[model samples]
Target: MNIDFEINIYHEDYHNAGSASSEIKKYLTQLGLNPKFIRKIVISSYEAEMNIVIHSLGGKLKLDIIGNHIILTSIDKGPGIRDIKMALTEGFSTASKKVREMGFGAGMGLPNMKKNSDKFEIKSSPKGTIVRLSWVIE
Candidate 1:
């Protein structure tokens, strides 16, 4: 069975930061996915959602279940990353002081997202950014 889920994420929507990831968790639970796998998915989803909320203008989190594989994607609209390499490093973030005061930006989001996924890819430009994370269920 193939399934797809998508959620729109708004910029600086701190109150609703993890909603998308929660929805993903609910759906994964309903689908009877293994708890271990679900944990990874949820962690990645939360990180992705938080990144979109804190960093981008706006974006969408898309989850696709194709047979035994799963793909989770984040597509944001504009004001992209200036340095992919630095962004991937832990403790490297461009979060505003206000955002940091809220304890939401530790610069670990991208690194955690990539670490939790079986496969990860990120592309960014002045226009936008896209992150794709994939996992295969055994």
Candidate 2:
């Protein structure tokens, strides 16, 4: 079966922080995905979602399920990361002081997403950023 869905994310919208990821988790659970795999997907999705909310001007979270693999894409139009390498580093963040004081932006988003996914790719330019994540069903 092939499944595809998309969710819109708005910048600095803390009111709906984890909603997209939570919905994805529910869908995956209903699809009978492996528990561990579902957990990883949830984490990855949450991170991606939060990134859009905190940094980007706006973006979309796209999810595609094909056969034994699940694909996640976060496409955002923002200032973009000047240094992708540094952005992926743990304990590195560009969030504002307000965002930090809220107990978010510990710099763990990208790293954790990469760690939990089987495949990860990121591209950024002055115009925007795109993050693609893939995980294989076990």
Candidate 3:
């Protein structure tokens, strides 16, 4: 089965950042995915969502669930990441002071997403950024 969802990206909104992931989790649970797989998907989704909110000007997330595989695609209209290598490093952050004040600028988002997802791809340009993440159920 294939499932898809669209999520809005709102800047600096922690309260709404994880909403997409939450919906994804609910659907995965309903589909009887393993707890570990579900957890990983949730974490990765949350991280990607936050990246959209913090880094991008604005964008949307598309989650695709196909049988035993889960794929998450995050598309944003903000400035693309100039240094993908540095951005993936642990403890590296570019979040603004206002975002940091919310206690979300520890810089673990990309690292955590990479750690949890089986496959990760990032495409970025001066115009925007697109992140794709996937994992197997088994």
Per-candidate clash tally: 0, 0, 1
**Candidate 3 regions off by >4 Å?**
none
Residues 20-84 of candidate 1: C-alpha lDDT, one tens digit per residue: 99999999999888999899999999999999999999999999999889999999997999999
Off by over 4 Å in 1: none
Q: What C-alpha lDDT values do all the predictions have?
A: 0.94, 0.94, 0.86
Better of 1 and 3 by TM-score: 1
| Per-model TM-score on C-alpha atoms | 0.97, 0.97, 0.93
**Pairs of colliding residues, candidate 1:** none
Candidate 3, residues 1-138, lDDT tens digits: the string is 777888887876767878888888888899887888789989988888888888788898898878877789999996899899999999999988888998888989989989999999998998998889988776
Judge candidate 3 against the unseen true structure and give its global Cα lDDT, from 0 to 1. 0.86
Q: Which pairs of residues collide in candidate 2?
A: none
